[model samples]
Target: MNKTRILDVKYALTQILYFASFSALMGYASVYLLGQGVSNSLIGTTLALVSIIAVFTQPMAASAVDKKVIKLQSLVNIILIGTVILSLCLYFFELPTMMLLCVFVGIVTFMMTVQPLFNSMAFLFEKYGIQINYGLARGLGSAAYALASAVLGYLVEDFGTGVIPLFYIIGNILLIIVVYTYVVPKNQQHLVQHEQQNKEETEQKQLSFFQFCALYKKFMIFVVGVVLVFFTHTIINNFFIQVITPIGGTESQMGIAVFIAAIVELPAMAMFNIMRKKINCARLLKLSVVMFALKHLLTFLATNIFMIYVAQVLQIGAYAIFIPASVYYVNEVISKQDLVKGQSMVTVGITASGIIANFAGGILLDAVGVYHLLMIGVVVSVVGGLIVFGSIEKKKANVME
Candidate 1:
C-alpha cells in the first residue's frame, strides 16, 4: 500500500462522512422543521439567513486559515466538533420556534461554510509530496449524499424528524475520528513553519483587493454569470419540496428524486477525464452553462412527478461538468498569485445567488406558487447561460478587442 492509495482512501472516507452530514441537515432540514411546526416562508427565511451569515463569516475564517491563525485540518476538526455539540444540543433540548430556528441555522451554517475548506483539503497533503485523487473522492462524496438522502427520508418517515439531529451527531463524530486518524507522519512543526513562511511571503507580494478586481474585471463579469446561473440551482435544491408538492410527491419520493440527482453525479464525474479527450474544457464550461438553462427549462415544463426525475438526470451535463471545468477555467485565465481569490470569487457568486434565491423562493411560493417560480427560473437561467457563453469567449486581455 502506497501512500497515495492510503491518503485517497482516507480522504474519500472523510468526504463521505462530511457529505452525509450535509445531506442529513441541509437536505432535509425543511422537512424536519416543517414537522416541528415551522412555516414554509420562515423556513426559506431561515435558510437565507444561513447563507447571509456565511457570506460574512466564511471569509474571515478563510483569512484566518490564510494568515496561519489556524491550520486547515485543525480548523476542520474544530468545526466538526462544534457541529457535534450543536447537534447534541438540538437533540437534547426542545426549544421555542425562535430559538430552534437560531440553533438550526448555526448547525447548517457551520456545515455549509466549511464546504470549500473540504475541497481545499484534497490538495492539502500535497505538501507532504502525495496528492489524493480529488475527483474520485468528490464523486464518492456524492454517493454518500445520495445514500444519506434515501435513508433519511425513510428515517423521517418511520422514526420521525427527531432522528435528524442524531444523524448529525453521528456523522460529525465519525468525521472527527477520520480527521485525527489521517496523520501526516512528516515533521508537523516543520510543515507549519514552512506554510506560515510561504503565506507571509505571499502576503508581502499580494495585490490589493481593488487591484485584483480592476485587473480581472472580465472574471468579475464571469462571476456575475455564475451567480445568475446558480440562481436556478439554488431554487431547485433549497426549495425542492415546493417543486414537487403540487404534483403530489412526498418526502420519500423527494428523497428518491434527490438520490437520483446525486447518484448520477459520480458517474458523470468519473467520465470527465474521458470526456476531456473529446471536448476541451472551455467549450465544456460553456456547454455546461447552456445545459444548466436546459435543466431549468425541463423543470419548468415538468407537470408530473416523473418529469422531475427527468430534469434531475440532466445533472450529468450541467453541474457535473461545470465543477471541474470551472477550476480549469480559473487556472487557465487567472494569474497564479490571484488563483486562491479567483476560486473564491466563483464560490462567492454561488453563495450570493443562494441568498437571493432562498429569500425570494420562499416569498414567491407564499405569494404566487411553484410554477410561477419555475417560470422565472427558466427565463433567468437562460439569460445567465448566455452571459457565461459570452463572458468566456476570450481571455481577459482580448475581451474588449
Candidate 2:
C-alpha cells in the first residue's frame, strides 16, 4: 500500500484498539465493583478519584508530548503497559480495598490521558500534510467499543467481574502490537520536531498560569460551557448500570444498553466530516448539548429497559457529533503554539465534570434513588444546553456587527 493508505489503516486500527481497551475498563468497571460488594457511594468515590487524578495527569501528559519529554507512541505504549500490569496486579494481588481503589485510580488516570494524546497526534500529523481521517478512525473506535461492551457484558455475566481485568490485558496487548508493528517511527519524530519548533517560535518564555488564563479568556468561557454539558454526560455514563438495574436490566442487558448507545454513535461519527462541511462547529456543539438534554429527559422518563434503549438512540447527536465537533472547535479557536495545552484544557473540563458527577451521582443515587438522580441530570442538562446555545449565539452576533 501507499504511505497514505498505510498510515490511514494504522490510525484506524490504533483507534479500535485504544477504544476497546477503554470500553473494557470504563464500560464495566463500576458494575464489576458492585459485583465485588462495593457500595454505590464507594464506587462513586473511586470514579471521582480517577477523574481527580486525571485532572492533573492529562495536562502533564500533553505537556510531555509537546516538549518531547517522550514520543507520543512511546508515551502511549508506556501507559498501556502500565495499565496491563496494573490490571494483573489488581486481579492477582487482590489487595485491600484502599489499595484496589488506588490501582483503579491509576488505571483510569492513564486511560483518560490517552485520548488527548491521540487527538494531538492526529492534528500534528495533519499539520504536516499527512491524511489520518480522524472522523472515520474515531467512528471505528466507537464500533469497537460497542462490540467489546456487548461481548464483555455476556462474558462478565457468565464468568464474573474478575474477567474485566483480563479483557484489559488482552486489549492493551493488541494495542501494543499494532503500535509497534504498523506505526511508522519516522512520522512520530517529524511530528514531535514540528510541534517543538512551533512552541519555540511562539513562546520564548513560558507564561505563568494567570497570564495564560488572561490570554485565553474567551476560550475559558467556552471551556466552562463544555464542562457543564459533560457534567450531565458523565453522570449518565458512570451511573448507567445503576439507572437500568432498578428497571430489571441484568448484566447482559446493561451491555446491550451500552451497545446501543455506542453503536448509534458510529454513523454519526462516520458522517462527521460531511456534517462539518454543512454546519459550523459552534452550532454543532450547541445542537449536541440540546440533544444531550433531551436524552437525559427521555432517560428520566424511561419506565422499562426498552425505553432506555430508545433513549440511547440520541447518542448519535449527543456524543457522536459532540466528540468531533469539540475537537474541531478547539483547533479552530486555539493557536498552534498552545495546541496541546488547549486540548488538555478541554479534557480538564471533562475530568472536572466527571469528578462532580461521580461524587454527586453516587451520593444522590444512594440517598434518593436512580429516578430522582436522573431528574437532576435532566434539569442540569437543559440549563447546560441553554448556556452553550447562548454563548454560541452571542459569538455569532458579535461577528455579524
Candidate 3:
C-alpha cells in the first residue's frame, strides 16, 4: 500500500477503537448503573453534571489548540491516560455503587471532551499531504460500534457490567498505540496549513464564540436546531435500555436494535461524498433532520420489538446523513480558523441537548412512564425538525467543490 493508504488504515483503526470504547458508555452505561442499584433520576443527574462540565472544557481545549499551547496528539494522549487510569479504578476497586457511577462519569466526561479532537485529527493529517478517507473511516467506526454493542449486550447479560471497564481499557490501549503510529510523509511534515497575516494580531485575539454567532447569525440558528433535533436522539442513545422496555425488549434485543441502527449508518455515511455529488448538502441536511422526527415517530408508535427494530432501520436517513452534512455545513458557513470553534459549538449544542434529556428524561421516566416520554419525544422531534429545516441555507451550499 502507498503511504496515504497506510495512514488511512491507521486512522480508520483509531476511529474504530474510539467509537467502540465510547459506545459502551452511550449504549450500556445506564444498564450497568441500574444494575448497580443507581436510581433512574440519579443516573440522569450524573450524565447532566458531566455534560455541563464538558460544555466549558471543550471550548477551552479548542482555544488552547488554536493558540498552539498544545498539539492535538498530546492533548488526546493526556485524556486517554486519564481515562485508562479511571477505568482501571472502576474495575479493581469495589466502591460504593455511587462511587462506581462517579468513576464511570469521569470516563464519560473524558471521552466527551476528547471527541472534537478526534474529529479534528482528520484535518491534522492534511498538513502531511495525506487526505484520510474520513467518511469511510467514520462508516467503519459505526460498524465497530455495531459489533461492540452486539457483543457487549450478551457479555453484560452473561458476565455483568464489569465488562464495561474491560471494553474501555482494551479499546483505549489500542487507540493510543494506533493514534501515534500513523506515518507522516517527510516531504509534507513541516508544511504550514495556512500563511499568517500577522502572528501578533492572531495570537492576541481570543476565541470568542458569541462573536462568531453574531457575525454568522445562521450558525446560531443552526446550533438551536441541532440542540432541538438531538434532544430525543441523545436520550434514546443514553437510555436505550429504558427505550426498548415498553415494547418488551431484552438486552439482547436492545443490542440488535442498536446494531441495526449503527450498521445501517455505514452505507449512508460512507457514501456521503457521492450523495453530495448528486444533491446539494443543504437539501440532504434538511431531509436528514426531517427523518430524525420520522424515526422517533416510528419508535413512539412501535408496539412490538420488531417495530422498534424497524425504527432502528431509519438510522440511514437520520443520523447517517446529518453527521457528515453538519460538518460540511459548518465548514461552508464558518471561516477556516474558527472551524474548530464551530465544530465545538456543534458538540456543545448536542451536549446541551443531552444535558436536557438526561436531566428531564430520567425524572420524566420516573414520574410518568416510557410511552409518555415517547409521546413527548414525538412532539418535540417534529418541532426540532422544522427548526432545522428552516435553518439550512441554500446560498453557498454548493461550495463543497
Candidate 4:
C-alpha cells in the first residue's frame, strides 16, 4: 500500500475503535439502565446533567488544542484510558445499584463530549497538509458502532444483561491501544500554524455577546431550527427500543434496527460529501428537514417493527444532510476566530434541546406512551423544516447586503 493509504487506514481504524467504545455503550445504555432498575426520569436527568456540563467542557477541550496544552493524540489516548479505568472502577466498586449507575453515567457523559478535541485534530491535520479525510475516518467509527451494537444486542438476548459492561470494557481496551499507537506525532510546524491562526483571529476584532449575536443571526436561526429538530428526534434516538420492544420485537430485533440505521448512515454521509459540490448545501438541508418531518409523522403511525425499521432508515437522510451542511454553513458565515466557538454553539443548542426533549420525552412516554412522543416529534420536525426553508431567503438577504 502507498504511504497515504496506510495513514488513512490507520486513522480510520483508530476512529472505529474510539467511537465503537463510545457508541456501542450508548446504544445499549437505556436498556442497561432499565436492567439496573432505574427510572426513565432519572436516566434522562443524568444525561441532561452530563450534556449541561459538556456545554462547559467542549470549548475548554478545544482551547487546549489551540494553546498546545497537549498533542491531539495524547489527549485522545488519555481520555480513552481514563474512560476504561473509570468504567472498571465502577464495575468493581460494588456500590449500591443507583450509585453505581450514576457513576457509570457520569463517566460516559464526560467521555462522549471529547468530540471537538477530535474535530480540532482533524482540522489540524488538514491544516498541516496531511491527506486526512475526515468523513472516511468518521465513517469507520459509524460502521464500528453498527457492528458492535448488532453483536451485543443479540448477545444480550442469549446471554442476558450481565455481559454489557464486559463489552464496554473490551471495546475501551481496543480504543486505548489504537489511540496510543499509529497516529502521527505532534509536529512543531502544525503548532506554530495553529498558534498563528489563533493570534490573527483574536487580533482582528473582539466580539461581545451582542456582537456575537449579531454576527450569528442567520446561522443561529438555522442552529435553533436544528435544535428543535434534534429535540424531537432525540425522543426516538433515546427511546426507540422502549417503543419497539413491547410490540413483539426482541433485543436482537432492536439491535438489527440500530445496525440498519447506522449502516445506512455510512452511504448517506458518503454521498453527501460528493453531492456537496453539485448542490447548494442550504437547499439540501431544507429538503432534508422536510423529509425528516415526514419520517416522524410516519413513525407516529407505525404500528409494526417493519414500520419502525423503515423510520430508522429514513433518519439517515436527515442526519447526513442537516448536520454536515449546518456546520459548513456556520463556518461560511462566522469569522475564523469564532469557528470552533460557532460549532460549539451548535453543540450547546443541540445538547440543551436534548436535555429538554429527553426529560419531557420521559414524561410523555409515561403519560401518553411512545405515540405521543412520536406526534411531538412530527410537530417539532415540521417547525424545523419551516425554519430551514425560511433561512434560505433570510440568508440571501444577508448576502445581498
Task: Give the candidate number with the greatest lDDT.
Answer: 1
What is the C-alpha local distance difference test score of candidate 4? 0.73
Worst 10 residues of 4 by lDDT: 392-401
For residue 294, model 4's alpha carbon misses the true position, in angstroms, by 1.7
Tens-digit per-residue lDDT, 286-382, candidate 3: 9898789888988889889998888899999999899888888777767666766777788778878999999998888888888888889888888
Residue pairs that clash (backbone atoms under 3 angstroms), model 3: none
| Candidate 1, position 129, lDDT | 64
Q: Which has the better lDDT: candidate 2, or candidate 4?
A: 2
Top TM-score model:
1
Which residue pairs collide in model 2, if any?
none
TM-scores for all candidates: the values are 0.89, 0.85, 0.86, 0.88
Of 2 and 4, which scores higher on TM-score? 4
lDDT by residue (tens digit), candidate 2, 1-401: 48878888888988998898798789887887887778888989889988777777887887787776787778888988888888889778777777788888888888888877788767766766787899789878988998989898899889998888888888888888877664545646765566666865566466655776798787777777777778778888887789888888878888888989999987787788899889888889988988898888888898888998888999989988888888777777666656666676777787788888898888888999888888888887877777777655322222211
What is the full ranking by TM-score, best candidate first? 1, 4, 3, 2
Instruction: Give lDDT tens digits, candidate 1, residues 5-99.
Output: 87789899988988998998988877888878987788889999999998877767766776668877788888878888888988999889999
lDDT of 4 by residue, 1-401 (tens): 37657766767876787677665567777777777777777766666666777777776765675666776677777777777776776556666766776677667765765666666666665666667887878988888888887888889899876677778788778766755665464555466547756675775466665677787687777777888888877877787677786567777888888888889878777787688778777777887787688778777777788987897788677776777877766656666666666776777778888888877877777777666767777888888778767765323323311
Clashes of 1: 0
Off by over 4 Å in 3: 1-5, 62-72, 180-219, 330-345, 396-401
Ranking by lDDT: 1, 3, 2, 4
Poorest stretch of ten by lDDT in candidate 2: 392-401
Clashing pairs in 4: none
